[model samples]
Target: MLKFRELLVQSLLNDKDEGEEIEDEQDVPIPRKNAKSTHIMKKFEGNARQNRKRCISCYDKLQKEKGTKEARAKTKRVMTYCDECDNKPAMCLECFNEKHPSKYF
Candidate 1:
């Protein structure tokens, strides 16, 4: 079996060759000057399965970085401040929820 480092190198080389092939093919249909090269972002265009796998891999990496076996928090928090209560930059989700209820708004 190929070692991990060799596998990574092979993948990188394959990616470079694929990109070169694409560039060569593009030149055949249109002149380089009139190509109007545009880079379309494809991060959100994958199917559900690809997206789920990517998410799982990212979550695993994050958990390893955090060095915690406990399930990560699902809630998303922003570096925001509560104007009503003294402006604190690191306002957590729980605190924000407790401070502002549905009826308050």
Candidate 2:
């Protein structure tokens, strides 16, 4: 049996995401990008099932970030990912630092 750490190292070196190898003895195969999409879709499904809505802060942030020059409170707050970082819970340092201490980074 592969040791846990060895397995992790193997995964890192494998260069392929484990989620991408969606297959079985049936010889069916799906690439990792599709697998990642499936995973995200499932999470979105669950969120939809719960009728989730953005928090006040998140809603405000969306409005501010997406607002045009006319800048008004938008009735629909569409969830968007950060184009710069694939929206993985990131804040640009220039804006984040004034509010959040550098140590948090």
Best by lDDT: 1
Model 1 weakest 10-residue run by lDDT: 34-43
Model 2, CA-based lDDT: 0.38
lDDT of 1 by residue, 1-105 (tens): 124454468677775454542333333443333222221112233464543222233335457776444315532333344444432223444444544444423
**CA-lDDT, candidates in order:** 0.39, 0.38
Name the top TM-score candidate.
1
lDDT per residue (tens digit) for residues 18-77 in model 2: 677523434533333332223121112235435433333344566688864323344332
Cα lDDT for residue 85, candidate 2: 26
TM-score of 2: 0.19
Each prediction's TM-score versus the true structure: 0.21, 0.19
Q: lDDT value for candidate 1?
A: 0.39
Clashing residue pair totals per candidate (backbone < 3 A): 0, 1
